[model samples]
Each structure stands twice: as structure tokens, then as C-alpha cells.
Target chain A: MALSAFILIEVAGDHTKSAFKTIQRISGVKAVYTVSGSYDLIVQVETENLQTLSDLLLSKIRAVDGVTKTNTCLVLNV
Target chain B: MALSAFILIEVAGDHTKSAFKTIQRISGVKAVYTVSGSYDLIVQVETENLQTLSDLLLSKIRAVDGVTKTNTCLVLNV
Candidate 1:
């Protein structure tokens, strides 16, 4: 089963372009999109399980130079 | 002094209309806006402190009928 997640990321400054490039390179990321307000970026990712998803985020996405903080929401389903 | 927080909310289904109404009614909400992809909604709120913001989210916003999950990001100075 694929576990889907949405990640809300806060960047250091007006680094949307750089941050977007970094996030797109991360594995397990299904899609990345920009939003109008508040958070700088929103990303959709799919993984086998929650643990792997957590690991990927911690080790990869969060480690990007421009990203300051991240919040993850697991898609429960409709 | 005030603390600014960005809230990422996931709804049970496609209840954007109802959810927006419920969120706007909550106190301390600065602005709420819809995003283009991934997460359903993004809200900007200002509070006296972190605890008050947390309380508002838990006791009020999160308690709304259609809300499924929320993740908050405290804004740090740029």
C-alpha cells in the first residue's frame, strides 16, 4: 500500500525557486506545487510506509539549505 | 508582542466551503487562504503566545466538524 503525505515547508527567505529545485530532487516525492500564501511550498509524496516517509523527509527534504521548517500531514483518505 | 503561526489543515472530504466558514469564525485568525495543490487549506493566525495559539487550534478550529488533521508552524523572524 502506498502512504500519501503532504508536506508544508517554510523557507529561510524568498528562496522559492531554490527550494523548489531542491525538493524536486528528493526521492519518493510524487509532486511539488507552489501555493499562494502562508507556507512557501507544498509537496505531495508517496511511500511504502510512514517510517520511510519520515526518514526521507528528515534526511533529505529538511536538510536542504534554504528550508527552515517543515510540517507533515498524512493523507488519511476521503 | 504576538506570535504568528501558519496552520495547515486537512479536511475529511471536499468541504472547503464549510471549513472556511468554520475557520473564519474562530478568534485570533488573521487571514485564511486556499492553496492550489496538495494540502487543502492554509491559515494565518496571530496570538499572544504559543500556548494560546495551540489552545485556539485544539479547542476551537480542530473541533470543527470537517477538519481531519492540523499541523502548525510558528513563524520565526526572517
Candidate 2:
């Protein structure tokens, strides 16, 4: 089963555009949106399992320059 | 452009299943997931504009039995 999650991202000021560009390049990221809220970006990502999902979140997505925090909500019943 | 959003919902105890059934019946809701986290469900909804989206969230989605709180993230750049 494919695991899909929405990552609510908060980035440092002045890094929004650059962070958006970098996040889109990450593997399995289906969509990235710059939004108006407490969070700056909402990212839709998919991976084969929970392990890969965590890897993407911790290593790839959070590693982007502007991203300060990521709140991940994994889809349980789709 | 069609406006889309993800609503992170927290519900009352033991109301998950009933709420899930009730939510999917709502007009604009595209997908509903039972998730494990601070929030219990993740709902994907689409409307013609922000006004309609807000109406759906406030009037329809939050009105469901179990749903106690909703945090909406509107898609700005998709």
C-alpha cells in the first residue's frame, strides 16, 4: 500500500519562494503550495511505506534551507 | 480556478466511524481519511472560490457529529 501524507511546512521569512522550488524537486512530492496561514506551505507526498515517508520528511523535506518545522499527518484510511 | 483545501479535523471520542460516514456525504468533500495524530481526520475539499470553501468548512464540515475542531489550509500555489 502506498503511504500518502500532507506535510504542513513553516519556513523562515524571505525563503518561501526558494523553499518551494527546492521542495518540489524532492522525490515523491506530488504537490507543493504556498498558502496563507500559520504554516507557509502544504506538501502532498507519497511513499511505499512509513519508513520511506519518515526518511523523506526528516532527511529531504526538512533539509531544505528555509523549512523550520514540518507537521506531518499521515493518511490512515483512504 | 477551483479552490482546494485540506481540513485537519479533531473529533470527540468514539465518533470517528460515524463522523467519517457523515463527512463523505457532504457535497464538496473529495476525500476523507482517519489519521493518527493531533488531528483525527484529514479532509480534502474543493469549491469555486474562497467564500464557498469557507461556507463548506464552517457550515457543513464542522457541523458533523464528532468533529470538534478544524484547521484549514487553502492551496495558494499548486
Candidate 3:
């Protein structure tokens, strides 16, 4: 089954738009929404499994230009 | 503009299914997905505005039978 998750992102400086665009283009990201609260955005992601989910977060999401923090809430089912 | 949010919920005991069903019926709850990690479910909510969102969370969602905790991340735009 595919792994699904929601990533809560915190961007640094004035990079919300740029970071949003970059994060949306990532291969496994399904949807990205700008939100208000403790975090700036919510990203819905799908991956092959736990390993891929981790790699996607570390190598892709966190690598986005202004993404300073990420908190992932993994979906339990496919 | 409508207010949107993702509510992370924590269910108590064996009430996941029951809590999910009850929550889905609430007026402003748009979608609900069972998830793992720190939260048990992620509920997509849409309300008329911030005040309505607050009322829904405080008066409805928190009042669900098995919902022990709720963390709301309100969507920015309609």
C-alpha cells in the first residue's frame, strides 16, 4: 500500500511563495495548501513506504529553499 | 470567505470508528482521514469564518464522544 502523509511546513523570511512553489513540484507531493496557525502550510504526500517517505521529507521537502521546519502526520492506510 | 482547516485528532480507547462516524456528520467537517504518528485522524474543515471555526471546534468537535484532543490548523483562503 502507498504511504500517505501531511507535512506541516514552516518557512523562513519572506519565502512563503517561493517555498510553496518548490514544494508543490516535488514528485510525491499530492497537494499543498497555505494555512494560518503554528505552521504556514500543509502538504499532502504519497510515497511507496516508510523509507521513501523519510527520504522525500529529508531530501526533497526540507531541501526547499525556505522550508525551515516540517512535521509529518502519516496516513495509516493506502 | 470560508475558513478551512486541518484538525488533527487523538481518539481515546477503541473509539476510532465511532469517533470518525460522529465527526463526519458535523456541519463544517469536509473530510476525515484516519492517520498514524502523533494523531489518529486528520479532519478537513470549512466554516464561514474564524468565529464560526472557533465555535465549531469548541462546541461541536471537542464535544464528540471519543475525541480526546484536537489541534486545528486553519486554512488561509476560501
Candidate 4:
């Protein structure tokens, strides 16, 4: 089954724009938006399974230069 | 300026679909999605400002049949 998740991200200093640009270009990232509040960005990602989701987070998203923190909210029903 | 926010919602019982359907039709609600997380659904809303956003949430969103709780995360940059 295809699984999806929304990742809430926090960046260091003022790298939100940079992080947004880089993240949007990444595969699996269906949508990315820069927002305020506690998180700098909210990203919607589509993946085949949990494994792929994990890899995308660890290897692609979290690996971004300005990304400081991340919280993953997996879509359960959809 | 137009302000947008993502509202995280929790609905009563199995009313997610019902709430989703109703919420999506509301004036200021740009998008609503059913998901599995700390909150059941995530809704994107756009309005003229915080006051209008508040009015939409209080009058339209909170009035939905199954909606029980809501948390708003305002978009800062975008």
C-alpha cells in the first residue's frame, strides 16, 4: 500500500528558504510549504512503505544543510 | 494580506469522513485531509487576516458535526 506522511521541520537560523528549495526538489516530496509557528516548514511526502519513508527522511530531508529538527506524522487511514 | 494556516483537527468517533466532506466545502477551507497522527485531519485555510481566520474556524469549522478539537498553526513566511 502507498503510505504518506507530513513532516514538520525546524531549521537553524534563517535557512528555511534554502531548506524549502532543496527539499522541494527531492523525490517523494509531494508538497512543501514554509510556515510559521513552532515549525518552519510542513512537507507532504508519498512513499511505497515505511522503509522508503525512513530513507527519504534520514538521507534526503534531515541531511539538508539548514534542517535542524524534524517530526514525522504518518498518515494512518489514507 | 492573505493569511493561511494548517488546522490540525480531532473528530468524534468515526466522523472523520463526514467532517472532511463538510469542512472541504466551507468558504475559507482551502483543503482538508484525513490522516493518522496525533490529530485526525489536517486542514489548510486561507483568509484576509487572523480575525477572519478566527471567524471561519469558530463559525464554520467548529460547527461541523464530528469535529471535536482544533489546533491552528499559522503560516509566517508564506
Each prediction's whole-model lDDT (CA):
0.77, 0.87, 0.86, 0.88
Better of 3 and 4 by lDDT: 4
Best by DockQ: 3
Task: Please name the candidate that would achieve the greatest lDDT relative to the true structure.
Answer: 4
Q: Is candidate 1 or candidate 2 better by lDDT?
A: 2
TM-score of predicted structure 2: 0.89
Chain B TM-scores per candidate, in order, are: 0.89, 0.93, 0.91, 0.93
Candidate 4 residue runs with Cα over 4 Å from true position: A76-78
Off by over 4 Å in 2: none
**Tens-digit lDDT track of model 3 for B1-78:** 777789989999878888888888999899888877778888999999889989999999999998999888877652
Q: Residue B71 CA error for candidate 1 (Å)? A: 1.3
Model 1, range B1-78, lDDT digits (tens) per residue?
A: 688777887777778768887898789998665544456777778999878987988998888888898877666542
lDDT of 4 at A73: 79
Candidate 2 clashes between residue pairs 3 or more apart in a chain or in different chains:
none
Listed in order, the DockQ scores are: 0.05, 0.58, 0.61, 0.55
> Candidate 4's chain A scores what TM-score?
0.96
Candidate 4 residues B1-78, lDDT tens each?
Answer: 999899888899989988988898999888888887678888999999878998998998999999998877787764
The runs of at least 3 residues in candidate 1 whose Cα sits more than 4 Å from the true structure, single-residue gaps closed, are A1-78
For model 3, report DockQ: 0.61
Worst 10 residues of 1 chain A by lDDT: A31-40
Candidate 4 lDDT, A1-78, residue by residue in tens: 898888888899989898999999999999998887777899999999889998999999999989999988787663
